[model samples]
Target: MTTDPPPEPTGAPAPTSTARGARLAFRRWRRTRPFWAALWTGTGGFVIFFLPMAPLGQILQVGVGGIAGMSGGVVLMAMALLILLLPGQRHTAGVIAVIAGVASFPLSNLGGLFVGMALSVLGGSMAFAWLPEKPARRRGGRGLLRRTRSAAETPVPPVSVGSGSP
Candidate 1:
């Protein structure tokens, strides 16, 4: 026997169960802000931060390196959060992240073995390059190449004839 689906309440909208719905929602959320930049920067920061804790021989014992790495990583991570929280300040965050990533190299286990440095730099670049969406100017589904009637309706003034030799 086939089981019947449960009935929904009269006024409530049915919940979406499909993964596609989730994906669409995520896409919409991503388009509105610098989501990828934040993710990459944060990941890089975490890598940099965790490397000091990892038991790599002689890696963490270097004088001041461990502290430097942790500090740089924390800065990068904070920049990522700032980018996500205040998109208008993304440029500032991006610049700070890049500087921190570069500084981490000599300070933090070679910038978490170079992985964290690369990721943070890349994320910062992406954030700096990101642009906000512009509102569409066209109405009535007009194509960019299509000319408006107003332009075509305007009459070109006839060229006036003048004596060549005065």
Candidate 2:
């Protein structure tokens, strides 16, 4: 005996919210090398600019003013923005960020200098190391949907009546 197929679902699938979609997209983007580099470089630069550090005179025994100690951080932040905005130019931006980070050593006090330099260098390296991933090619000629056999193409076995004789 044949049985009927299960009934189809009564309602439509749940709709995804725009906010959730946006969040998912953002999460995916954050996983990329460029995003991490931009984040680290930007955060490092901001820290250097905001955090208090030893006075220039105390660190280098020079008469330079406090503003001079924050210039490297500013450069780092600018380069990070460039990398984020124009990923195609990441190599150039990364190189500039590295140079600016190194230069920050002499310009800034010890506190911001080491941390800022380390973060900026790491970010720059990440940017430089980024390589575009290639898309995978689909295999086989089959479409996404599965093909079902037509009723005519399916063969049915012979159904016999109760016959006791061999």
Candidate 3:
């Protein structure tokens, strides 16, 4: 008598390549918390520094303050961009940003003082909180999930010799 081969099993649908890539990208981005914080703060700094100009002109009747205000806002914006560019040096950059934000207040840009200080301080705090993650090692070498042994490594049960049978 001949036996047919076992039927193939089918169940879950496979994920598409695009879905897999997106998942990987998301994971990579999620791991870099400090980088995201820096980026957001930098963007907010730029917007806040420039957004007040029109309002200031309408309210205070100053198209633009003297060089001190302009330079301070420019410097704060520059520091924010610098932080975004150098995530590895986030702590140092963040501290500098916070200091610059404070200085911007006394320099005549109150808008920069509030928005820049709040965002930069938060970003700096995040940078301080971030910890470097270790690289994942291959399985079977003191890893969390060890690989199962191949068929070659499987032990064979010994057969009894010369057993009496009908």
Candidate 4:
């Protein structure tokens, strides 16, 4: 019998090799750990760290407050890295990240104008709540109903009907 090629998907154009590779690579990386949590946490940390030091068209001077804010941001970013690298320590990292985010408010320009604080808190929450998915169980056949042995192969004995008193 002559073999036929499988039909291509409709509506969407085929992805280029580089695009496909990148997508697959990202998917693989994301599946292995809490990628979003790490990214958000790092972003929040960056904002918290840099906002205080940034000069608003004037002589820039980072004082003790800036230092504190920078420290908090660094802690948050470290926590994010911890979560990404050591997923087992996610809970600890998450808690620390949240605390750092909250602490950054007074220290880092109102927690990077609240944006950084929000991102840090959100990222920490996600890390804390993240859970591994269970693998699906597979059977060797299709359809919902399972195959069973024939009734004749496992016959049931007949029961006689008797009408008298017990």
- Winning model by lDDT: 1
Can you rank all candidates by TM-score, best first? 1, 4, 2, 3
Evaluate model 4: give its TM-score. 0.68
Better of 1 and 3 by TM-score: 1
- TM-scores for every candidate against the unseen true structure: 0.71, 0.62, 0.53, 0.68
**Residue 100 Cα positional deviation in candidate 1, in Å, after optimal superposition:** 0.7
Candidate number achieving the greatest TM-score relative to the actual structure: 1
Per-residue lDDT tens digits for candidate 1, residues 1-166, read: 9999999688755566466788899888788788999999999999999988746565556657787788899999999999888989999999999999988999987898999999999999889989988876866565533555578776799976895756
C-alpha positional error of residue 74 in candidate 4 after TM-score superposition, expressed in Å: 1.2
Q: Kindly list the per-residue Cα lDDT of model 3 for residues 37-117, writing each as its tens digit.
A: 665556545645665556544635654453455555566556556655556776776676666556556554664647755
- lDDT-sorted candidate list, best first: 1, 4, 2, 3
List clashing residue pairs in candidate 2. none
Q: List, residue by residue over 97-143, the lDDT tens digit for candidate 4.
A: 99999988888889999999999999999899888666777766553
Worst 10 residues of 3 by lDDT: 139-148
Worst 10 residues of 4 by lDDT: 54-63
Candidate 1 matches the true fold with a TM-score of 0.71
Query: Given candidate 2, what's the lDDT at residue 26?
Result: 88
lDDT of candidate model 3 versus the reference: 0.61
